[model samples]
Target chain A: MLHAPASPQADLQSEPNDFSAILAEQTDRLLAQHVTPACLKAADGGVFPAAAWEAVSDAWLPLALVPEAAGGVGLDAPAAAQILRRSGYHALPAPLAETMLGLALWSAAGGAAVEGPVSLATGLLRLASGTILAEGTMAHVPWAGAAGHVLAIAEAPDGARHLALLPRAAYTIVPRRNLANEPRETLHIGTAPLGPDALLPLPAPLAGPDGLMLFGAFARAQQMAGAMERCLDLAVAYANERKQFGKPIGRFQAVQQMLAVAAGESAAAGAAAQVAAAAWNTDQFPLAVAIAKARCGEAAGKVAEICHQVHGAMGFTQEHVLHFITRRLWAWRDECGNDAHWQERIGRMVCAQGGAALWPRLVALRAAANGDRGTQP
Target chain B: MPDMRFATVAFPKDAEDLRLQVRRFLEAEKADGRFVPHRSSWNTFDPDFSRRAAKAGYVGLTLPEAYGGHARSSLARFVATEEMLAAGAPCGAHWIADRQSAPQILRHGTQVARDHIIPRICAGECYFGIGMSEPDSGSDLAAVRSKAVRGAGGWVLNGQKIWTTNAHRVHYLLALVRTGDAGADRHGGLTQFIIDMAAPGISVRPIHDLSGNHEFNEVFFTDHFVADDFVVGEVGDGWSMVTQELAFERSGPDRFMSDYRLLTELVDRIGPAPDARQAVETGRLVAHMGALMAMSGSVAALLDRDIVPNVEAALVKDVGTAFERDIPEVARRLVAVEASLDAQDDRFAEALADVALRAPSFTLRGGTREILRGVIARGLGLR
Candidate 1:
């Protein structure tokens, strides 16, 4: 029997202090110190930052989502997500979020904690006769070549779902990269032998395939929000420092207005991300997550455009570091699901409930999440 | 960049509980068929409904008990206001007086003003209109030529206020006038006075909007008399007071929820199982709405703490009004419905037409988009 280590749930429950703020501060400090322009340039040129990865791992970020008893830090979903937000802020060209999510998902499925970095496949796999097989090519698998194992949610012939852990060698890796230069490879999984220890029944809470997509969307929303903050910071600094009409460009109403719009977008994205993060523990997979992803993704495009416009020609060049954050925003918005993809889901749900039920449904969803009774208005 | 403060606010249990009571009240009104769910939203004038709502203790929620108000937290007021807007309740009659005028009187008006006006406002018998804009000074409020000279015992006001919503119907106008010269700062010498609409030398001419609605009016004052007790706050401090009052006006759910009924009607038209395009567009709008709601909620929380968040409030109105403007556009694209105000049977078309006509004013009223962005830029320390 593959007995899992003691869960970190008890330890996390005992600490009443806000770990999210502490973890956010720690991650911000780590990235500010380590993720330099030189590191980013190297990563952009297809060179992986093994040293940066080592530093992040040394900080115990990879174990951030797991229980402390499982040799993890026992940070809850929102706290772990804060770390990812900081990672995005620095545009750290590594698989930090992927590794954190992969480890947590694997451990949640009752798998023994592993040591090396892990990546998750985009789609579900098929399980038959105690063997796991890929239905089609799993596209845009994050950091596939670097990760030692790939985690995927698979469905069996009996319609039971399982979390399957496959060694990297089990599938052929077609190397690809997103706009941010992060590793977004494709996995061509043939018939792969998975021992009983590598397969665990999918947890009841996440039995449906939408769970993976929802989790991915939630993570990307946080990253986009953080990246937007960085963009606004860079644009504001540039606006104040650069002078076009004898005074700082910030003195110009046009430039100030552009920056103002960007700031509004950033604020909106940040608020939406926080709303989504607060709903991480809910069972219904709350529509707030969908709203967050859709809203943040839409804001990302506008924020990036405004920041670039405010920066002028210099922002379009490779010499500037603004691209480091903006590029990641561009990539993250379209990664889990684009704005259109999630928006459609929300629209369909609301439409299906009918016009009269719309406000009631929204109020009910909010009430349910907050443990309050639904209002009838 | 320095961190922008938009902390998440947790509504107290009592606030959430208030939501159920409000909803129940609204539900009873709906069951009784008090008024149709019209497209006008807060602009719908139904004095009977306002009186009923006030009798039910829904008006003057944030004022003190000494003024016949419930003195509930702003969060409680926020929940109630959102419920009213969502239900399309005809709250227009007391909306302005309840939202800003009463609060302003409580904060700045004299004991006499508060005693005479706040209780009536709380009882839904009194109504007020903002007297800020004039023919020459639209967004440039500081450039006002409306002069007020000292009389024997009070002030004689001479000015014209335009685009004053419900001015012809309301009892009073909190008019901002130039009491002194424009000093070096250009913000000094302004004064606010509570003027009686029915007094001598005051006349209101209705200005019908594009939708043929008589919601706005032009008020001309030749020698409008305002007693010393009607002066709001200190003399020569009207500029700051007016700005603070705008912070209240621009930050509420009204900014974003103006065209919400159109969204509900759009959903109804699309029905369940919307196609790819319909779902995607509708979803995008909902996403924007959710973000706006969160932003508006945070502003309410800040106002509750007595922190006048001018910049944050400006940002909310700018972003929120833009969101309001986008709903009709998105709805028109998702479904093919000819917009007409008189489309009796087609609720969607009627809503689309009503919103389409009213949407232009969303960014124009309270503050223009250009003015709001400038305010935001100043808040960002850019200017």
Candidate 2:
């Protein structure tokens, strides 16, 4: 079934002033300054980039997505997406996106604001009477070791969904890392006892199946877009600086062509991620995010290949800074349901609608997005 | 970073409001058996269909009311054009005139040319063919050998233009010819002229495509006389005019939605329940299309702002055409049917065959992928 446009009241419920230019500028400047190569390398070695994390914390970046009524800056999903892209651009070791989304989820669930970092986990839980029992293992829990709390969404046997805010100490953490050397640990929960207040009802959007995954995929798409932007930057700079046959390699059509393709891929990823962000909280969310995750993930691989190919052997070495962004791109491409996963999901949904319905469906999706505010130029 | 950004563009409410009307018109056309959607592409030339579409107020959109146009937003035109392409409407007769030439003429052509040509285009009684490419000038447009010399009342043109689509049928050809010395830049000598195809000293030879279609043509001009009133913009300023026109040409729904019909057929043919591979591949194509539409739509928004998105346009064509080419490749892989035009009983197979044969031109026309990428590389400051 096509995701119909949300009602006027439901649309008004969202923070209309979601994207603020001032916040976007401030976030961009902050990421550019503090999330430097040195901090990234330090975080790669498993040492928390305390200064960078503190800077973002001081800026209230983690709480940016929390609703203003909940005593936090009500940055909507579009603005949050821009910040996430910046986080990916700098390859910031901290789980800023994860934390921001986690806090937002927690706040929406009527949970009190907690300090420090928060990581996100998804699994199943057993709810009997008033007791909440979490016993499953959540793999690829981003920054679980560094976070002070874990925001989890687990489905119950009775088809009820609950959001649990559990302290990090409650669950056993097995440290792990992604291709970018950033923490993406696994959490093993053995009958973790959640306080009665720890379990709260979810917001409407997240009350459905794969709600967190939808947002997670959208976040990863934004990050991939940011990483692709950086990779293109590095490749273009290197192409103009690196000389081959007594001329800058950029002068060659082959190198220019490759970098050109990289630019297109980066633009496509940006467009997809931005549209997905704009579709947040609307009926178009699942379809838009699916397109974003699939398109951005596919663009990520092609862009990384071209960016690296343009940089030659230097980009492959650890000494070069391109890998900081490229590796994160690779890791993010696999996260939040990889390209094939989302592609199949989109394909199944679209095919079921039949070929005749595809045009109207796509137009309706665009129409719903157009009816929103964030999509304005 | 690269300064190459596809800004978020949403269809304006006015444009969205027009979507239902366009769909209704298309459906009515389909119900009346105006054209077979499965057998038609955007390149399908039918003057009767074009006339009806014009009467429905889709042609000459975004042009001035003074010139018999509706004076709608580019986004409105974007929505209308995409609707036409999606329905596989035979839009070739008015496609060029409504898309690029009419606008170019309105913007730069003489008062006489605009007054005479624009209204006819709006009425779907006039058509245009691009006369930029020549036998020796494919990608090297600046290397055009066509030249026009001062004549009795205008300039006498003499040269050859190849790959001119609809040359034999189009009433006019917007020919780019050299009129002066080729300065150091090589772009200095060019000029654009609105040539009357009915004039003497011009001949068109059909170049049959691989599918036995005669859409492509090679035209020879021997002293084809173009009056002074037909000149578009100032002499020696054709390069900028043509480049500006390209952003309009390369960035529209036409770039990516050429093979959209085949995609729809593929989805329907695969049925409601596709195997994992088929679903995954089809989904990938849809995702790519979604992104391309956004990118292309963003370019439309940029054009509406009068900010020439040259590089952005190039990126759209490059990526969009790639997606267009990928449709047939993906379609054949998921289904076990021999693609043939003779498979009249199987719409999917026939659509697949038609697109497979025409796919190569999607990238080659407007601008080749390599050329577009080169343009993008330049935008990235790599040139």
Candidate achieving the largest lDDT: 2
Q: List the residue pairs that clash in candidate 1.
A: A8-A67, A344-B279
Candidate 2 chain B weakest ten by summed lDDT: B1-10
The clash number for model 1 is 2
Off by over 4 Å in 1: A1-23, A68-71, A131-136, A190-192, A283-286, A364-377
User: What is the lDDT of every predicted structure here?
Assistant: 0.82, 0.85
Q: Across residues A203-272, which tens digit of lDDT does each residue of candidate 2 receive?
A: 7767656667776887789889988988988888899999989999999999998888888888888988
Give interface RMSD, per candidate: 1.9, 1.7
In TM-score terms, candidate 1 sits at 0.93
Highest DockQ model number: 2
User: How well is each residue in A1-377 modelled by candidate 1, as lDDT tens digits?
Assistant: 11112432343334423344555677888888788999999999888888888889888888777766667776656556667778888888888877887888787767897876888776877765667564457888888888998887777788777878888667898889999888899888778677767888776546644657777787788888889988988888888899876999989988988988988888888877766655555643458778888989999999999999989999999999999888889899999888888888888888888877777666543443243111100
The clash count for each model shown is 2, 0
Model 1 lDDT per residue over B1-383, tens place: 55555654556688889888988999899899886665558988778888888888889999999988998999889889989988888889899999888898899999999999999888888989999999999999998889999997799999899999999889998889999988998999999899898889998999999878899999999988889999999999999899989988999999999988889999889988889898889888877887777788888888988989999899899999999999988899889978998899998999899889888999999999999999888877788
TM-score, cand. 2 vs. native: 0.95
Chain A accuracy of model 1 expressed as TM-score: 0.89
Per-residue lDDT of model 2, residues B1-383, tens digit only: 54555766667777877777888999999999989898897899999999998898889988899988999999999999999999999999999999999999989998999999999999988999999999889998999999999999899999899999999899999989999988998889899999899989999999999989999899999988999999999999999999999999999989999989999999999999999999999999999988888898888987887989999999999999988998999899899999888897999999998898998899899878888988998899988
